[model samples]
Target: MELEAAAALGKYLGAGIACLALAGAGIGVGNVAASFLNGALRNPAAAKEQTATLFIGLAFAEALGIFGLVVAMLLLFAV
Candidate 1:
């Protein structure tokens, strides 16, 4: 009802919304792994060769999620 209360509510809501980025990151990581496995299944020999690529993709995707989480935490605690 008060202005400060409204602002605080907004901050919490914004932080919650920012967490949605993690969901997108999760989906992206899942897609990357799924595609890699699909290709690996079809080519067993090359699967070994592509393991590094798969992990790199996974790390990149996860990094985005971690960044999103940091943003959410900053919103909740910093601003």
Candidate 2:
């Protein structure tokens, strides 16, 4: 019973951390978008080139958010 309670507490704490990662990812994605916009404004002709790189940046930022979501799910289900 004690072990079960301990596991439950640990799982809940881990889930909290996982949720925090989403906030970090949000900040990162915002930064990426802001930089891309700034670059595009500086050179309208380079917007096309910047778009591709912006997507790559977004993919990485979003992947971290997805990982956090997966961890939250795992904690809720597997734990």
Candidate 3:
């Protein structure tokens, strides 16, 4: 009812919405891993060579998730 309460509610809602970005990151990570496994199964020898690529993909995906979390935190606490 009051302005302050409504603003706080909006901030919380915004933070929650921002956190949804993590879902994309989760899907990206899963896709990368699944694709790597699929390829590795077909060519076992090449799996070792692709291992670094897989890790890089995982790290990038995880970083996106972390960025989303940070944005959510900033919305809730700072903005």
Candidate 4:
């Protein structure tokens, strides 16, 4: 019984650590947006050309957050 309790505790702790990736993803998204905005403000004409890249960066950042969520879920329920 004590071993089962220890396993459960470990799983919860691991899940919590995995969730930190979400925080990193948030910071990454913010940095990408800030950099794009800074560049666009300086060069209004070029902003149109780089819009696609900006969106790609945002998508990647969001994907990372989603991946983190999945890992946490799996750790909590599957492992």
Winner of 3 and 4 under lDDT: 4
Model 3 clash tally, residue pairs: 0
Question: How do these models rank on lDDT, best leading?
Answer: 4, 3, 2, 1
lDDT of 1 by residue, 1-79 (tens): 9998997999889889878889999999999999998999998889988999999999999999999899878878887
**Higher-TM-score candidate of 1 and 4:** 1
Whole-model lDDT per candidate? 0.91, 0.92, 0.94, 0.95
Report residue 67 deviation for candidate 1 (angstroms).
Answer: 1.2
Candidate 4 off by > 4 Å:
none
My TM-score estimates for the predictions, one after another, are: 0.85, 0.83, 0.84, 0.81
Instruction: Pull out the clashing pairs in model 4.
Output: none
Worst 10 residues of 2 by lDDT: 44-53
C-alpha lDDT (0 to 100) for residue 70 of candidate 1: 92
Candidate 2 regions off by >4 Å?
A: none
Q: Write the per-residue lDDT of candidate 3 for residues 1-79, one digit (tens) a residue.
A: 8999998999899899988889999999999999999999999999999899999999999999999999999988887
Global CA lDDT of candidate 1, please?
0.91
Q: Which ten residues in a row have the lowest lDDT in candidate 3?
A: 70-79
